[model samples]
Target: MDRVPQVEFNPMAGLRPAGASFTVFAELREQYDWFRSTVGQGFWVLTRYERILEALNDPERFSSSAITVLDPEPAYRWIPEMLDPPEHTAWRRLLRPHFTPASAAAMEERIREHCRELVDGLAGKGGCDFVADFATRFPTVVFLEMMGLPTERLATFLEWEDTILHRPYEPGRATGRRKALAAVVGCFRELIADRRAEPRDDLVSAALAWRMDGEPVAEDDLLSLCLLLFLAGLDTVTAQLAYMFWHLAGHPADRDRLASDPAAVPTAVEEFLRAHAITVTGRKVTRDGEFHGCPMKAGDMVLLPLNSATRDPAAFPEPERVDLGRHPNRHLAFGAGPHRCLGAHLARLELRIAVEEWHRRIPAYEPDPDRPALEHAAQVLGLDTLPLRWPA
Candidate 1:
């Protein structure tokens, strides 16, 4: 067997011609075996499937304290995502119960109701931008509802999330984004203050009243938890839904299979997640380590390309093709280990409901080839705008 070749991380190496719908970063995972890039002065890049997983599982050896590659000035310094070990675990524990299967299952009727209304509004329209009209809005609303925020304030949540994820490094962008996010946090602060006065049946109220180690979660902790939930739940899953629908529209046969068997929705959701897995989680080596015969020194950065890993031939056969009925499918789209996505159950539920409801209404949906879709390339890879049309 030929060993996979390694390449230096040259960001420009993968640039496509102007106006290209897709970029080389998406393709480089398959065409080039591995690439080395510096995250900071000392950090290194691990761009392969096997090594990425190994690093994710061994958080003791590879710490997630460096989740973002951008400089850590501004308020970005304190988000829980940049913390390691016991600290990260503590924050995660506080937020986990709210997303439990029981909790997520309870939201199904509400999710379906939201989906029905969104789709019904555009029911007979000849075409629409799936990303804005449905994908982006749906998850934002669901997350706000979960967090006990007023549904009218969802735009505030979306603006803040986009800033944290996309414009962390840009001063102008960060300023506007942070201001809007701070406003929402201010609202939460008041809500927390109010909940203290009059508690209610919501995550915020529950979190306010709840205790950890005999101390109620502080205001900052409550705000940080809400921030994490907004970033995790809204950004990733919305993009996942857009990508799934894009693929389904292109593959009519798969759409037919799903439309014919609504029961296959769960299986199809799993397959879509596996096939279009987004986000490249980063970790830094805590100590010198060896993975797949490659020496990784302390402070080195590793990129876990979930999409590439899902398609690894060693893991899944015919890794590129969409197999809705794929059995025994185990992919790391949601990631693995302690940092595995906390909202995985809710994300899957959202995807299943979105697809089932979509096909039930528009079985023959297809993308508008004339106006190609757009994808956001950050830590997470996802569709920005997916335009589609069907017979009205």
Candidate 2:
């Protein structure tokens, strides 16, 4: 029998071409069932839908005590995600309601309003950098509003988010990220204090009042949760927005179909997510074992690109095509298993708003001819400059 092929994979290589990084995985997925890649600290690569889903499901063997692939020192110990079952379940119990479907539904109008304002900001202009003008605005602003944040100092959050996720590898970026992390936790502390004194209807206040194991949640625990929410919540949706907008701008057929039928917007959102799933997460192998013919040892890294699974041909017919009507879309864009994204309900609402509102106003937009969509990748990958022009 022939051995499976392995290629040295670099996560940074994905930054150059828009959505090119996942294509590398897709090629490997088609050529071989799995491959070995020098991703992050290096680990066996799983590109197939079943394999990636298997790892995410069997967290016992692939314990996610820490994310080894990105950042030698991760910005913060994100709750629930970085934890295993049982312990993870406890934290999730307290945090779920804040991001529940009901909660996200309640915030839909506010989110829609924010998206309209964002579109309005770029309306008269011939073109706008989707990343700068719109992509960054929706997630950060909505997050700020949802948490009862001032929304004026959104620049601070953006800076922190960029520092932590975009390029922590650059000199001084790691240090900046650590400082930014401290600042984020400090702000969360202040919010907790205020909520303790006079509880509001916001997430912070709700968290403060909540009891874990018949006692109030600990200070550090609350801070970790807040830090995670800020980092993960603001950034992932922002990146996805950039990719989705860039794709729809380029492909008029899908864009028109979605615009023509508002009801199809939700289904189109899933296809967009599947086609451009941005992140590639990691897991630490718990015990020495041969995983589906790949050699893995305890403490070894297992690079699980959610992008890989979502694009696997076995999972979706013609995985590359952005089929708006791809019903029963079981993509892992929001991840799977115990660590599935808590903000999924919020993200769906946000994505739906972005698609519906943007298409409503700028119905005939396309990628700017002069400047191409320049992309970047890390734990979260996306376009920073997606210039789009419409009929003026």
lDDT of 1 by residue, 125-222 (tens): 97899988899888888887776778896776677777666542443445676676787677778878887898778887888865767887777877
Model 2 pairs whose backbones collide: none
* Candidate 2 lowest-lDDT run of ten: 67-76
TM-score of 2: 0.94
RMSD (Å) per prediction:
3.8, 2.3
Report lDDT (Cα) of residue 310, candidate 1: 79
- Tell me each candidate's TM-score: 0.88, 0.94
lDDT of 2 by residue, 137-182 (tens): 8888888877767788888888877776776354344677678788
Query: What lDDT, from 0 to 1, does candidate 2 have?
Result: 0.81
Using lDDT as the measure, the top candidate is: 2
> How close to the true structure is residue 153 of candidate 1, measured as C-alpha lDDT?
69
